[model samples]
Every structure is written in C-alpha cells, then in structure tokens.
Target chain A: MRNSIDTGAVICSVFAAVALFGAGSLLALMGYLVLKGLWPPMRALAALIFAHSGDSLLSIWIRSLFLLLAATLLALPLAIGTGIYLSEYTRQNRARELILSNIAGLGEMPPVVYGLVGWGALAPYFGEDRQTLVIVLTASVWLLPQLIVAAYWALQEIPVSFRRDSLALGATRWQTIRWTLMPYSGRLLAAKTLEGMARVGGEAAPVIMVAAAWPDSSKQPLHILPYYLYRSLIEAVDPATTRHFGAALLLVLTSVCFQWAALRLRRTGVVAGDTLPGLRKR
Target chain B: MRDSKLVVRNLSVYYGDFQALRSINLSIPLGAATAVIGSSGAGKSSLLRALCRMNELWDNVRTEGQVLLDGQEIYGPDVDVTEVRRRVSLIARHPYPFPKSIFDNVAYGPRLHGIKDKRKLDEIVKRSLKQAGLWNEVKDRLQESALNLSPGEKARLCIARSIAVEPEVLLIDDPTYHLDPVSAAKVEDVILELKQKYTLVFATNSMQQAGRVSDYVAFLSEGALVEFGPTSEVFARPKDRRTEDYITGRFS
Candidate 1:
C-alpha cells in the first residue's frame, strides 16, 4: 500500500529532469571558467590566484575578504538578535507577521537597486574613504535580511522544547539563547555566514557604484571581483581577458572551499546536537 | 495554606478568545508528588505550565486570579518570571538535550546561576547526574555528545539538568508519555526519588501512571477541577462521580 509508483512519479520526474538540465548549464559554466583560468595565455595559472597586472593577486583577494568579513561581522549580531527576538520574545500578531514578510521580500530585491541607493545616500558621507565604507554598508544591508531569515528559519527548526527545557532549568531568556539555542544552531549559523560571503563575492553591481571612480590597476585595495571581470571585458585598457578569467577562477575556488568547509562543519557538528544519519560515522 | 507549596485560587487561563482553564482552585502540598490527571485537552498541562509560568513562552495566553508559590503571587505584574522559574522547574513531556556534551548540558544550569568555579560545577554535575541515576552509565563519556545517548538516557539527563539548578518545585509534565515502557519505568522511578528532595507536580492522562508516581492526585476535566485529595484517599474513595467513573474505567 505504501510504495506504489504512479502517474505522480512520472510527472515529478519530468520536472526533475528540467531542474537537472538547469544545473547542468551551471556546471558547464564553471568548467568553462576553470578552463579559461588554467589554459596557456594565462600560463602561470599560479599568476591568476597569486598575482595580476600591477597588483598582487593576494592583496586584491585579502581586500575583498576584509570587506566581506567585516560586513558579515557587522550584520551578524543585528541579524541574530532579530532572529532571537522574533523567535522567543515577540508574540505572534500583525506586527510580527509584517516584519517577517518584509524580511522575506527584502531578499528578493535587486542588488543593483541597493547599489544605486548606496551611491546616492552614502557617497557624500564618506569622501576619500567612500569606497570601503560604501562597500561595507551596502554589503551589510544586502546580507542582513539573508542572515536574519536564515537565523529565523534555523531557530524555528530547533525544537521549541529546547527553549522550554532551558527555561524550566531556571535559565532566563538570554541564558536560554546563549546556552541552548545558540549552540544547537552553530552549524546553521556557520553555513549562512559562508553563503553571505559567497553572495558578496558574486555580486558586482553594488561594488561598481562604490569603486568605479578608482581604477582597477590603482590597487586601492578594494574589490567585488565580478565587477572587475566586467571592467576587464569592456575596457580597452586591459586587452588581456586572461586576468579577468584568472580572478573569476580564484573567486570560484574560494567559494568552493568555503562551501566545502561548511559541509564538513555540518557533517561534524561544532557542538553536540544530534546529526544526520549520514554524518554519524564521521 | 502555609503547608501547601503552591496554591491556585480562582485561577483561569485563556488563549485569546477561548478559555483553556475555567476558574479552578487547588493546593499542592510541599515536598510531595501531586499528579494532575485528565484526558487530552483537559487543562492538565495548562495547570502544570501555569505553576512555573512556562505558559508565558507562548502568545496571547492570559491568566486571571492568583497562583501563589510559597507566598508570592506568580502572575502579578512586576514579578520577575525568571526568579519564579528558578524556584519552579518543568520537565516537559519529551526528552530535550542541549547541543553539548553530557557534562555541559548538566552544567548549564549551575553556570547560569553564576557557579563559575570549575570544581563547584563538577561537584554539582556529578551529584545531579548521580541522583538522576545516570552518572555511572555516562561517567566514562561525560564529554561525549548528549545526542548520542539512548532516548531513555536523554530523558534522565534532562532530569539531571533540571535538578542541577536546585529548584524548589519540580513540574513534570507527562513524564513518560512518549517513552518506551522501560524508559517510562525508569523516569517514573526518578520522579519517585525526586519527590524526596523537591516538591513535584506531575501532569499525566493515564490513571495508572498517576497511581504509580503521585502522592496526591488532582483530577481535572473540561478545564475544571473535578476532585483533589491524597492519592490513597482519592483513588480509594472519590467524592465526585466523574472522578470515580474515571478511576474505575467507566469513563475517561
């Protein structure tokens, strides 16, 4: 009675095939990027990740990492605090409902719109210091909704019984969060942080508005890689496409590494909550 | 009144429009196991949760009249809910272990109470686990993840976690409801042992379970108290026909 296959299976399979096709294109793009990164004119594939025209590739990367990390750190507490308040403190009502819905909607907004807003509002406040400040502010706002949403869902996924249990043990609301809920959700928190960084790596529009005035070769020590690649493709000043490919490849490699670390963290929980059956052996 | 650890006078609870508990009056004696028995949706859990103000965790839940613990009114405005919970702890229906090693889970309560001295915490964890009857089994693996323990062991570990806080009253809500028989028996035994040191109020639907673990019994039906008396007297001679019928299996 339970395992019978039916027309539903065939219908779902058709959609699965379509989804798989979409994934295949993404894989093809990645392979192409890798090929471009590794091939001849790019010779020292080492040069791609290590050094680029005029600037140390490592410096470019370190700057990008700093922006992403700083922005994420800025957003982390605010987002996690929002999540905790929503999950434990606030009562369910029209206001809470509105806030949650708005957060979800924020995730759907265009990144370029954020770029425009950053250009207009933040451009003046930070004069020569504009690029770093703008990127940090834009990246934080862009990432806030995502991390909070992930946190909200993560807190929800944690059994409510855990909260009750903590309280019953004489813990205050803050204690319940610090001792019980936070530890239980460590993996989720880590994964979402990585996801946020990858998003910053991939999004170039916001970075363009902030850094366009500064030449890529100026080595002002700031970046959003996709935008730099875009500049390389369009501007005649940099005829060699290899550098763009190299940078793009480095970006991909870093994201892949972060995802790998996240996966490993999930497989072996940093704290002692239950794990998936597949992860039990590890 | 002085002897009763908790006294509920004209108490009523509501969730928005619907009243979950009608005006009810009962008293729980000090340092004894008082079991509130009723069918599902019978307000047994509502009564237990109200004892420690655990109901505050949810939305739109409101309480009327007085729930006096010792002598202080728990539901009164301006009374800190955290202090009340420290005095009155609840062990929910199912096992819930924090995402930590077994030792850390038990140590969480003491650490919360500001017992930062490593030696003091170690002692508390050991005593609590031993009292919960789990120290021997888990001693070798105190640092092991609490999640890896069997379901029965986790339930006991939760009890150890609660006792480590040194609460004055223990509210056990359906102690063994979802557990296997052996686990249920073990949890029942732990509750029995617990009442020796802490005043306990247990909520359960099964009459037989109430008989096994309670020193006093409070029978509730349709959000109202049907009967309240000592376990021996309540089970032996019920003044209310509903209580009698329920105990005799004539009705639930």
Candidate 2:
C-alpha cells in the first residue's frame, strides 16, 4: 500500500508539472505578443476595421476569415461523404486498407506540394483572371485529407453498441448512420472542422504559390493574414518585424478562438445530455 | 418440432480465425421462452445473435449454414436482410438508448418501417411500453431523454423499443447481466410475461434464471450444445454428465 501510494504521488506530481509548464509557456508567449505586437499595430488595426478600404492588417484578417470559410465549405461535404463511405459502407479488405493508407500518406504530404500542383496544373485552365479561385481550390485540397481523417476518426469514436443497437432494431445501414451515428458524432465533427479552419486560416505556402505577393497595377489584390505575415518577415526591416509580430498575434488569436469554441461546444453538449447517462456521472 | 418458430441447421460462426460457435442444430418453440444457458465464452450470445443475423454486423465475422424463420431461409439471396431483422429482433444485454426522447426511442423501430401517422406511433409506443412494464414509471416523462432512466428502467425501455415494431421473435441476450438483484427480478418478470406472446429465446449465465424464466433450456459448453430439453426434465435427469454437473453447481 505504501509503495503504491508513493508511486501514485509521483505520477500525479509529474502530470502537474507538465500541465504547469504548458500553461506557463502559453501565458508567456501571449504576454510577449500582446506587448510587442498588439501595441504597435493598434491604430492601423482600428483604422482598417472601421474603414475596410486598404490592404491593412485587419483587412487581411477579414480576408483570411473569408478564405477559411470558403475552403471549409468546399471541403466539408466531400470529406464527410468519403469518411462515411470508408467507415460504414466498406468491409475490412485489402483494397480498403490500401485506400486508407494512401489517405494517411496524403495527409502527411507538405502543403507546398499542393501549392506547386495548383500553380503548374490548374493555373493554365483557370487562367490569370481566376487566381483567387485557384488559391481557394488549392487550400481546399490541402484541407480535405486532414478533414476526412478527422471525420473518419470522429465517427469511429462512437460506441459500437450504437450501431449494433440501431441495426438490431431493423434500421437500415443508411438510417443507422443518419439517426444515431451522425448525431452522436456531430460535436466531435464540428470540433475537428473548427481545428481544420484554424489551420487553414494560418496556412501561407499554398496561398503564396497561387496568389501574387503584393497588390500591383497588373495583379488582383488578394490579401490574407498569412501572406501578409510572410511578406512582412521577408522584407527584414525593423517595422516589418513589428508587422509580422502583429500578424502572428492575429493568427494566434484566431486559433485560440477556434479552440475555445470547440471546448465550449463539447461542454455544452455534455450539459445538454448528449452523452450517455452512465458516462455523464464520470 | 411441428411447433418450432425458428430452425437452425449446421450453424457455425467465426470471428476471423477464431470460431465462436461450432456447427449446432436447434429448434426454438413458438410462443415460449427458450433459454440458452452457458458460462462465459460458451457461445450463448453467439447463438442468440446468429438466430437474427445480428452477427453479420461485425467485420470479419463469417456465419455459415442456415437459419430459418417460419420455414423461410433468412440467409437466402432473395430475402431482404432488413425485413428479417424487423421480423426477428435482438435485445442486447446493455441498454443503448439513442440520444433522443423516450417516445422517440420506442418509436424508432416503427418509424424505420415507414409508419408516419402520429396517432399510430403514439398507440404503438404506449402499448409497447405498457407491455414491457415500463409505462407506469415513464408514461409521464415520455418526452424526456431515455438516458435519464435508471439501469432497470433502461433495460425495460430497450425491451419496449424492441417490441414496438411487433417482431415475431425476441432474442434477448442476458437482459439482466448489468442490473441489480431487484432490477434483475423485474426484467425476469417482463421476460416471463413477454413469452406468452412473442417467441422468446433468452441467453443467460445463471442456471437459476434459466429455471425461473425458461420453458425449454439448451445447455451449451465450449461452443457446442451439450444438452437440450424441457427445463424441468433437464434439471431432474442426467442425459449428459456435463449438463447434470452444470445444473447441480459442480461446474459452470
């Protein structure tokens, strides 16, 4: 008993230390970014928000939001459909395993490869006039594999008994997926989608290959936060450092908001009796 | 038997390379409670699942041989799998109330078969819940989430849900495995009552429960049927040494 108690205490202390370290690092980073980044760009951000005219930080932030929404809208249905097909309809076979392995491989491929594909392959068909469309398509392609994997895992996380019970009640496979599996995994799917949106909001490489660096007389203006930050850093000037920091701050804020929304959704689902009664007590 | 509701011939079940149930033949009587009793991993649940084709839901699960319901082969190519399931439903040991209201949980089966009239659904739900002996406790809270019910209530609610579709056979796989003694007794009572109407095939680990609730008992040991006969005769006579030992508490 004494040895077990000591071991338990040691495990608890180790976990506590890890938790403290993570929280401390996040706080330190946020404090530094707020002091250095938010302060320098406060006036310009305010002006951009109010005027909505030029390619300023806030304008780029809004544009990033738009791109994130558009790309997510394009990718979500296809990813969910593919996920459902893989998880529910297919039996365990060599072909299914091969397809899943390929999807996993695609998820790990660099975003720059997707950007290169968009530039070399799709640009000619779309022509120079539809650069924004190409950029949106490239971003959606990058986001698709990740979202598909997310959706598959989310559906997998539902208890097998739900499917069994539904089927035992004479529900068709489609009805089971529609009524039980979808509702039970809805919050998880939404959380994953939000996390994906956070990632796409801050992605720079794919956008750069498809979008022009700066707004020129000949080029269409396509300002997003990540591209703005990339440009600011590459300039390598003192003011550019502050601008990049500000952009970094905005990206971090967007990610934090997405994470917060995900957490809030999970909590709200539990409170609203989305979880099983047996699990709710725990 | 001429009165048999379901006939199983050379039934074998395999999960990957592991065979859970060996080739076994049995006949379940109509409008009577037949108990499949065995110890853990003794293929009782497999037999129940196989009766209604529920075993096919799992991946890598291969079921062989024939299961006939009312002289019709359920595994035949022309048979509608969904129709078979609707005709013969399995009530799992654990209750899984969908994340829906009590009314919806019971109405789920009827609705799946395309019953859209609200009045008809309401009547079915009421009758089913009443038949399961859960109507008095839950009638006021029919709109409440089924998850909020106690363990015993949830078990009965699952029974209610299963019967709402009015299936011919009710294959209950250890309905009281997770319930307390009082709750277990209550579920046993519901099972006893249900046998008067539906052809009930119950799988259990308890010999006493088998004696209490079943008219005919099929004793299984290690994926094979050891003995099967009327419960009173099987309890008294030693047709097989293993069945005699099991009923006498010499071994599980």
Candidate 3:
C-alpha cells in the first residue's frame, strides 16, 4: 500500500506538471503574438475607418468576413437536414453505413482539393469573372461534411431516454424530434456551428487556388484575409514580416473568439441544468 | 385474472438475431400493482416495453405477441399507435422531465392530445401533480424548470406527467432504480396510492420492494417466468427452485 500510494502521488505530480507546462506554452504564444503583431494593424484599421479611406486591407478583411458568412449560410441548412436524415430517419443498414463512411472520407480530404475542383471544372462553366461566387461555392462544399458530422454527433449525444420518454407520452416520431430531441440538442448544435464557422473561415488554400486562377481577369480580385496573409508570408521582406504577423494574429483571434463562444454556450447549458448529463448530477 | 386489464399471449421479443424474451403469457389484474421481479437482462424491461409497443421504437427490435388492452388487440394493423401509447403510458427507469417548467412538463401530454384551454390545462396539471403526491412540493414553483427538482421530486414529476394523460394502465419500469432509499420509499408510497385508480405494472430488481409495493409478483429468470402469484403467497411458498433460490439470495 505504501509503494502504491507513492507511485500514485508521483503520477499525479507528473500529470500536474504536464498540464501546467501545456497551459504556460499556450499563454506565452498568445502573449507573444498580441505584443508583436496586434497593435500596428489595429491602429491602421482604426485610422482608415476614421478617415473614411477604402484601404485595401480593410476591404480584404470585410470580403473575408462576407465569404465566411456566405459559406455558413449556404451550408447550414443542408448540413442540418442531412444530419437529421442520417441520425433520425435512417435505419442501421448497409446504405446508412455506406453514406456515413463516405462522409467520413470526405471530411478527411484536404480543402485544397475542393479548390482545385472549383478552378478546373467549375471555372470554365461560370467563367473567371465570378470569383466570389465560385469561391463561396467551393468553400461551402468543403464546409458541408464537417458541419454535418458535427450536427450528427451533437444530435447523437442526447440520451436515448429522452426519446423514449417523449414517445411514451404519446408523442409521434416527428413530434418527439421537434419537441424533445431538437430542443435538447440546440446548444450543442449551435456550438458545433460556431466551431465549423471558425474552421471554414481560417481555411486559406481553397480561396487561394480559386482566386489565383483568375489573376489576369478584368474584375477586381476578391480580397480575403487568409489569402492576403499567405501572400505576405510568401513574399516576406523586412517590411512584410509585421504585416504577416498581424494577419496571423487577426485570424487566430477570430478562431479563438469562436471557440470561446462555443465553450461558453456549452458550459452555460450544463450549468443551467438543461441537459441530461446535468440532470444526472442529483 | 377474471377482470384483467391487459392480457399477454405468446409474447416474444428479439433484438436482431438475439432473443431477449421467449414466448410468455400473463394476465395483468385490473386496479392492482403487478411487479415483474428479475435480475438484469432477464427480459423484465422488454416485457414492459412490449406491453405498450415501445420496443418498436428501437432499431432491429421485433416483437411477436398479442397485447390485449381491455380485450382489444393493441398490435392490430388498424390500431393507431399513438392512441395505444396514450392509453397505456410508461414511466422509464430514469426520470426524464422535459427541459421545461414544472407545469409544462405535466401539461405536455394534455397539450399533445389537443387540450387548449388554459384553465382546463391548469386544473389537469394541478390534479395530476396532486395525484402523484408532488403538488405541495412544487405548487409554488410551477414555472421553474423541472430539471431543477430533486431526484425524488423528478421521479414524482415523471409520474405526474404520465397520469396527466389519464392513461388506463401505468407501466413503470424500476422507478426507484436511481433513487436513494428514502426517495424510493416516497415513490413506493405514490405507487401504492396510484394503484387504486390505474392498473399498475412495474418491473423491479428487489424482492423486498416487490413484496412491499405489489399485490401480485411475477418472478422471471433467463427470459422465462419462474413463478407468479400473490405477493404473500410467492414469498411464503415459492413453487420453483429458481424462484426459491432467487428470493433466498442464492444468486442475483
């Protein structure tokens, strides 16, 4: 017993040290980025906004925001519908297994491949002038599988007891889904949505391929933050280094904010005693 | 069994290739508590779920049987499943109060059946809670989320929710499975009181609880009925060796 206790204490100390080290590393990285990169770009953006100058950087950031929103709007319904169909409507059969495996495979594929598909197959049909449209389409497609998977897992996380209870109360299957399953899974679904948005927003490769394919077009190229950051890094001279860091800081901040919101929503749901896991506490 | 509320004839349940319950027959007496006592995986839950056709909700679960509710074939093709469920309500092992107000949880069933009058709904909610012996505890906080209630109160709330639909037969599957002893006793009191108005069939693992709460006790082992009779008689003189051994604490 003495040896076991000593071993256990040593294990706990090691785990504690590991956790503190990981947390310290993350905090240091964030602090470095904020100090080195955040201030200059923030001041420049503020100045441009105050002067009413259409700075190319501000416009690119705005375009990036618009693309993110557009992709989210386009993908949300399709993902939710497909998720509901897969989880609620489908039986445990070969067809469902096939569809799920294929979706898993699609989720694992890189975003650049989607960009290539847009550039090669879709650009000729829609022409090079529709850069925003083509990019949104490809980005939305890339976002679909991940969002659907998130939605599916969120819905699945709800306890089966809820479904059984609702149906036992004379609720029809659709009524059970609407009244019980959907409401209970709402917070989880919203959190997944925000996380998906962050992921798609930070994706630079798809936007790059589509945008670069039409550099010589007469239309003004769509300017997004990820693409601009990529260009700044690739062409990094003495002056461009700070710009690259600034872009990285902004992207990281956006993703962190989204993740923070998701965490807050999930935590509030648990604390408010709205979930089954919370209900088990008593 | 002359005035049976429900009659099960040759009931069997299967989950894909595995059989959960073999062909079994039993009669549930009207306006009395019948306890189906067994160890885990002895098909007690399957039998309860099959009575209300709740087993059909799960994937790969198939039931072959005839459950007669007041002599009407419940599994008949022409029957409306929702009506059957409403008539024969079930309270699961765990209390699953909707993430809604206490009043709303009780009113959910009535609203589903198209009870729109606010006064009528209020009356039903109050009456059901009172019937479940929970009105005094939660009357002041009708709008509070049901999830905020204690485990015992939540169990009673579930009972209230079921009775709000005014089901003829109340099938409770181990209502005290997750409760402390004090809470379990309170639930047992509610069950004893409820049997006066509705036909009660419950599944439990405790022989003591079965003796305390049920008028009739059916002992199940390995998906088959070992012995069944009045609670006193079964406890006093178990006919089967398996039933005798189980009651005497030989094996769970």
- Which one is best on TM-score? 2
Candidate with top DockQ is 1
Poorest 10 consecutive residues of model 1 chain A by lDDT?
A: A273-282
True-contact fraction per candidate equals: 0.80, 0.76, 0.78
lDDT per residue as tens, model 1, A1-282: 334566678879999999998978767767887777666665565755566554555667777788788999999999999988887777778998899999978966888877876776776566555577777888888889888887886676666667778788778888888877787677777887787678766788887776644444353645456766666677757564567777777677778778878677666654334432322100
lDDT of 2 by residue, B112-196 (tens): 9899999999999999999999999999999998878998999999999999989999999998987899999999999989998
Shift of residue A228 alpha carbon in model 2, Å: 1.2
What TM-score number comes out for model 1?
A: 0.88
How well does model 3 score by local distance difference test? 0.84
TM-score of each prediction: 0.88, 0.90, 0.88
| Per-residue C-alpha lDDT of model 3 across residues B6-93, encoded as one tens digit per residue | 9989888999898888888899999999999988999999999999999887789988879899999999999999999999999988
Candidate 2, A249-280: lDDT as tens digits: 78888888998998777665522544444432
Error of 3 at B166 (Å): 1.5
Model 3 chain A weakest lDDT span, ten residues long: A273-282
Interface RMSD of each: 1.7, 1.6, 1.4
In model 3, how many backbone clashes occur?
A: 0
